[model samples]
Target: MILLKLFWSFFQIGMFSIGGGMAAMPLIQNQVVNLHHWLTLTEFTDLITIAEMTPGPIAINSATFVGIRIAGIPGAIVATIGCIFPSCVIVSLLAWIYFKFKELTVVQGILSGLRPTIVALIASAGLSIFILAVWGEDGFSTNPLTINLVSVLLFTVAIFILRKWKPNPIYVMLGSGIIGGAIYLLI
Candidate 1:
């Protein structure tokens, strides 16, 4: 029953979450943290961090991590399949439809309109993550005592490095991780 539930939950995530993995973050949090109570908000946020730092889509990485935590290898397989199944079907259908209607003004207009919505979804996800990193699961508070200054500092430095150097992201991530680890050891 748990396995089935895991499969169904991820299948729904894959089906409804448009605009790629970042857009799916909120839905994944809702399902795993709010609905299922499989993980706390903090845990979900941590999982998102791990997922972002790993390979593959964030949704798939999240599904696999949760599934393994819940029910080991079999659960991971079922969850991964569930997460990818909808995308497989949807992409296939859309490919055919897109080719068939490639020249239609209505189709082009619809596609154009989706751009803003997708951007909004991605932005919302990024904001959620930033909030989580800065304030944890408790969310923002009027008192500055609860804010994570280390996270904020790291975030600012990362942005500065990106804007200033324009180096490959792999180096930035590695440097951040090393800096974060050093800070962790110091404090």
Candidate 2:
């Protein structure tokens, strides 16, 4: 039952999410957080951190992680299939007709326009994660008027510095993790 549930949940995600990886975050969050109650917001953040650090699509990694959490090895199998099946089918079909239809103006136009939508979806997903990271601590009392403002300011400053200096994303993520850890300890 758990395996079936995992499969169905991820299949729905893979089927509906029109863009790749980051574009899938919102729906994945909704299913795992709101629908299934598989993990809390804090847990989702942790899983996302691992997903970002690992190879493979974020959505697939998330599905496997959540499935394993639910029902171990079998759950993982189901989730891997759920995440992959749609792409396998779609790509196979497209491959058969892609050459013949490659010059179709409508198809070309649709693909071109999809780029912006994909970017927008990924940006919105990032914002959602940022919101979660700011205030997802359970039972930790934070003064919204003071601490929240500090956090927001720090986040803005970090982004500004990152953009200006242009360092490796890995280093930035590691730095953020260290800072988050220190803040948690302090609070």
User: TM-score of predicted model 1?
Assistant: 0.94
User: Each model's TM-score, in the order given?
Assistant: 0.94, 0.86
Best by TM-score: 1
- Which residue pairs collide, candidate 1? none
Candidate 2 regions with alpha-carbon error over 4 angstroms: 137-150
lDDT for model 1, on a 0 to 1 scale? 0.91
Per-residue C-alpha lDDT of model 2 across residues 2-84, encoded as one tens digit per residue:
78889999998888777888898888888998799999887887888888888988889998899889989889889879988
Residue 97: error of model 2 in Å?
A: 2.7
lDDT of each: 0.91, 0.81
**lDDT digits (tens) for residues 149-185 of candidate 1:** 8889989999999999899887887888899889989
Q: After superposition, how far is residue 17 of candidate 1 from its true place, in Å?
A: 1.7
